[model samples]
Target: MPVHFSLDEYRTRVARTVKAMAAADLDGLLIFAPESQYWLCGYDTFGFAMFQCLVLSGDGDLHLLTRAPDLRQAQQTSTLSDAQIQIWRDLEGVRPADQLQDLLAELGLTGKRLGIETKTPGLTAYNGDMVRDALKTERLVEASDLIAGLRRVKSPAELDCIRRAAALSDDALDAALAATRAGVSEGDILADMQGAVFRGGGDYAGNEFIIGSGEAALLCRYQSGRRVLDPQDQLTLEWSGAWRRYHAAMMRTLVIGKANDIQRRMHDAAVEALEACEAAIKPGAPMGDVFDAHARVFDAHGLTHARLNACGYGMGIAYNPIWVEFPMFYEGNPMIMEPGNAFFLHMILMDSENGLAMCWGHSTILSPTGVERLSKHTLDLVEL
Candidate 1:
């Protein structure tokens, strides 16, 4: 098996998950989240875009029900034996959920109270409905947060992967900074950045690197077109370095030439907010308090109108479409920060009134002593 963690580590994870399932009063769990599956047994695959499920019984038995294509995928990447992996045929009237039901019957889990992960990209509504229809006789409850909560705190091995990813993130940023200048195309900067990560033995990021210039610099998400940098232009970038499916993300808004007064003020505010957030993110602190600190700093600087509602979120063991994880920093979130918790906190300021954007962000791991900023880059404004 190409499992990254030791057999003992995988066993411990399975034990903890089984304990959580017991606490939830579930007889078994239908884990649909690819991240959850990967965390549990190193079952890595994008095949989750289709119908695939990992059934974890109360006694800690794992059985993966997937399509034919992922049979070898699981065999090569996961710790599962060939017999433990059940192939669900794609016949005209057949549904994977029905195969899951049969597998459950063989495992004697039919009609038992089951927990289903319904809030992931791996489980679309169409498939969810089919699952409900197939397992109608069984008592199913939503249990997405069980694994999510457990995965929030990184293990030592997981942190090592994230630390390497963080270094790659810094390297990518340095490459992008060196490649960025007047007359340069966004494509060239992107190529340099991604190439830096790949050259460092990093994996593809969970999502496309967000790159925009000029007016589009205000965008926080990736969009379709690309453009060259003007002599005096603004560029915003949001990217992550992934290793072993774990991500460490960073965000920045760079000025091609000299930064205007408004942009300078916004950058200062972003830096201040980011620092304040860093100070607030510690063991025993509620995640909401961190966001509150960010809000107060930005509002104090008269940049409340330009600030993002949420400051950041946990990042690790991610898949396509996004790298954001649980314990999101927002108002009234009571999730407490604990040691080994890794998160990416981005302070973004998009001033539509002035048609400018400024941002500062990096990943950090919370330790018992204090917050450990992953990126080695300074917060100074990058003026190319």
Candidate 2:
């Protein structure tokens, strides 16, 4: 298997998961979140988009039920072998849940208290009902965020991946900035950025690369053909470096020409907010306190209405639709910060009145004493 971590790491993860399972009073854990399953045993595959499930019993059996395409996928990318896999045909009128029921029985999990992640894209409502109906169990607890909570804190091995991923993000940003000249289409600049990522041995980000130019800079997403850049245009880039599903997010803006007074003012405010946020993020600090720092800077500068409600969020193994993890940085979040926890802090100022977008931030990992910026990129606003 092309497992990313040592076998010992997987063993450690499973042991931790077992302890969590016990705390939740779960005899058998039915995991449909690919990240959770992969963390436990290096079982990687996009087959979670369809009907699939991994059964982890307290007795120490990791069983997977999946489609035919992932048969070899699990072998090459995951820890599961053929003996441990149960393939369910996708034939018409044949429910994959039937196969799941059979596997549950094989693992002696019939009617046992099963903890399942009910919120992942992997576990469809139809299939969830199928499994629930087939199991006839006494307790089926919703443990959607159970593994997510455990994974928020990174291990040393995971930190290494985040470090490399952060470097990859910086590389892409460097390339994109170098190519951002007057009269260039945003699409080409975006191509250069993503190309740098792949060439540097990084995987595609869990979400779309948020890049735009000029008026589109105020709008944070990619488009087919943004207006050509001019001498006084602005560009915004917000994307993550993905390595083995771990993400290190970074965001910044580039000005094609000399910035005006308001532009510089907005940029300064954003940078201040970012620094304040970094200072507040550390072990023992409340998660909401980080956002409070951000808000303080913006509110001080009279940009309260221009900022987002949230200043940051957790980042880890994520799939599309978004990359931000749960327990994000919003006002009043009571979750305490912990070491090894990775999160992104971006201060976005969409001053439509000024027709400018100045955003600045990066991903950081909390430490015992303070926070460490993952990327080497400077937080200063880029002026071309």
Candidate 3:
């Protein structure tokens, strides 16, 4: 198999998952999340857009029920044997859920307590309804975060991928900075940024890069139009690097020709807030503490109205649509800071009064003694 992790590591992950299922008193898991499938057995495929599921019995038996398109995909990328890969035909009037029922029956899991992962894009609400109808059993329960909890703490091998991804993220910023100049189109800058990752043998990120300039800089999400930079403009960007599906994200707001007084002040507040968040990431501390620190710094600067509600979020092996991991840095979040946990800390301030935006962020991996900032780049505001 062309899997990223070793066989032993894969076995260990499966073992951990099965143990969790046992603790929950689950007879099996109807796993639909692509991340869970990849993390469990290295089943790499975007075929989850269709009706595909990986069924894991409590005894550690694995079976993948997917369409013909992903048959070879599972064989080439995952640890599953040919027999373990069950293809559900797309014939007219055939429902995949019925096929899933048959598959479960064959595995002696019929009417057994099954945990379903419902909080992922892999299982659309329509598909979920079909599955629920076919199963027709109250044994199915929501266990969306079961695998996610285990995934937050990165193994050494996973950390290796995250570190490489972080380097690629830094390189992308360098490429963007180098390409930035007056009269440059946002398309050209985006091309340079993504090209840097591809040149470094990196994978596509879980989501599109956020790039905005001038008035659009106040917006945080990616939009369709492209704009050329003015002589004096503000450019806000948020991007991530992916290696073997693991992501390390970063964000920044760059000044093209010169920065105004409000922009400079906002940048200073963002920097101070980001640093305060970093200091708050101590071992055993609540994830909310980091956000608290960010809030305090920004509010103390009298920019509370301009600041984002949340500071940051955990980052890991993510798929398309988003790269945000759970236990997001919001007020009152109780997720603990532990060694091997990777998180992205972003301090974003959008001042509509001045029509300006300032953001500073980077990814970090928590260590036994301290948190290690993944990016090699300095935290100084980039004035290009």
lDDT of 2 by residue, 23-93 (tens): 88888888998878878878777789888888889866789888999888888887777898889997878
Residue 203 CA displacement from its true place in model 3, Å: 0.8
- How high is the lDDT of residue 156 in model 2? 94
Q: Report the lDDT tens digits of candidate 1 across residue range 1-384.
A: 478999899999999999999998999999999999999999999999999999999999999999999999999898999989999888887888888889999999989999999989999999999999999889999999999989988899999999999999999999998999999999999999999999999999989999999999999999987799999999999999999989999999999999988888898899999999999997887999999999999999998899988999998999987889976899989998999999999999999999999988999999888989999999999899
As a whole number from 0 to 100, the lDDT of residue 168 in candidate 2 is 89
> Ten consecutive residues with minimal summed lDDT in candidate 2?
219-228
lDDT digits (tens) for residues 1-384 of candidate 3: 489999999999999999999999999999999999999999988899988999999999999999999999999999999999999998998899998999999999998999999999999999999999999954899999999999989999999999999999999999999999999999999999999999999999999999999999998899999999999998999999999999999999999987878888888899888889989998899999999999999999999899988999999999978999887999999999899999999999998988889999999999898989999898777788
Model 2 segments beyond 4 Å from truth?
none
**Number of backbone collisions per candidate:** 0, 0, 0
lDDT, candidate 2, at 298:
97
Worst 10-residue lDDT window for candidate 3 reads 258-267
